[model samples]
Target: MILITGATGHIGAAVLDQLLKITDPGEVAGLVRDEAKAAHLKAQGVQLRVGDYRDPASLERAMQGVRKVLLVSGGADEDGLQQHYNVVDAAKKAGVACLAYTGRALQNPATLANELMVRHFQTEEYIRASGVPYILFRNILYMDTLPQFVGPQVFERGIQLPAGQGRVAFALRQEMGEAIANVLADSRCDNRIFTFTGAATYSFADVATALSELSARPVVYTPIEQPAFAARLHAQSLPEAVIQRISGFLTDIKNGQEATVSTDLADALGRTPASLQEGLPTIFKL
Candidate 1:
């Protein structure tokens, strides 16, 4: 059986959907923390296994009878690395055949110089040492998360961020989901790292133009100082730790960390991945 962690989430759900098409639904198990959120998946004949990354016993139970597992990376918390270790330890103990992890596209040195990348690298190292065949999907930034950078006042207050002229190879989240599912289904993808990315790169200015075109509103990209940006986020009631983490992301972008473009995703999916222009409409609900 194939077990997927975070199955109720966007990437997990998409992977589940794609997996169901090529495999028997009963052969797949979804590790979920909330059964209520997994109602639709359960109704579709997917086996629901209650599990939490922080709970090793639960993961051990979920991994029973599971040959392969997709260990989706946890959220941006200080405990995330430990949680990932917990999953890896459980997977090792359960004798899982293959373990796939979703991580960041770390091409530039600038990208690796942040707390986010540090944690990912740590997890990758741990996974490698776990004695299981693994696939690392080093994904680029998601175009779906552009709204967080553009802010809610984009149409009215225009766009503002600390990222200055930094381009990102932003891939569509759903397409990424499909690509990940494709990897899990194929045996040849074992013990490899895939850089899942879009066909093109876009800067914030380009993003503003796209938003302007899509929303038919005057959207302008304004470069702001990091301190000012932090202050603004603070005024909005964001935690200091969260604000610092977000600022570090912007710092990486400003340093041109996320600018690399790769065709690995296209090669994996057997087609050119969607660019920002084609994906913007769907993401912004235009």
Candidate 2:
């Protein structure tokens, strides 16, 4: 049996959908805190297990009889690392065949300075040392999240970020989920890492051009300083912590951390993942 955490979320639901096609729905279980929230999954014949990353006992219960488990990354608080350790510990105790994890894509992750980015690498280290067969899907940023950076009035306010000219190999979230499910269904358990990415790399300037074409109006790209960017977010009433987290992400992009492109995503899905041009329309509702 295979279990996917955060089954009710966008990526988790996408994985479950693809997994159901290649494997029996009865062989799948969704780890969710409240079973009522996953009634839709249950309707699709997926078993729902009540669990929480912070609750080790709940994870143990969810790991029961599961051969493979997918750990979807989450948590914004400082306790997040401990939560991930709980999941890994529970999976190890259950003696699961494999433990799959969704992490960030970076060549030198150990050199990362961001708080959350460091946690990701730390989690990867803990998983490797746990002595369990594992697959690390080091995913890039999702194109779906581009809408947040673009805001509601791109034509008028234009585009502004601290990312500078840095590019990202942004993959579609749904395709990433599909690729992940493809691996989870396989029984190989190679204990490998896959650079989950899109077909091409694109910068924010390219984003402006795309929006200009879609909106039939001039859309400009303005690279702002990190402090100014944070001020803008603060003007929108964003909390200080969220502002810092977002700024860290922009800093990483500006540092060229997400610039690398890889065909692993296409290889995993047995087809080329959607390019930015093809995916932008759907993501921005154009």
Quantify all predictions' global Cα lDDT against the true fold.
Answer: 0.87, 0.90
Q: Give stretches of model 1 more than 4 Å off.
A: 108-113
Residues 1-286, model 2: lDDT tens digits: 9999999998899999999999988999999999988899999999999999989999998899999999998768789989899999999998988999999997577555456888888899999999999999999999999988778888788999999998899899999999999989988898999999887888999989988888688998999999899888999999998888888888788888888788899999999998877898898778
Per-residue lDDT of 133-196 in model 1, one digit per residue for the tens?
A: 9999898988899988787778999888989888899998888888888878886536899888
Which candidate number would show the highest lDDT if scored against the true structure?
A: 2
User: In model 2, where do residues sit more than 4 Å from their true spots?
Assistant: 110-113
All candidates: TM-score: 0.95, 0.97
lDDT of 1 at 51: 90
Best by TM-score: 2
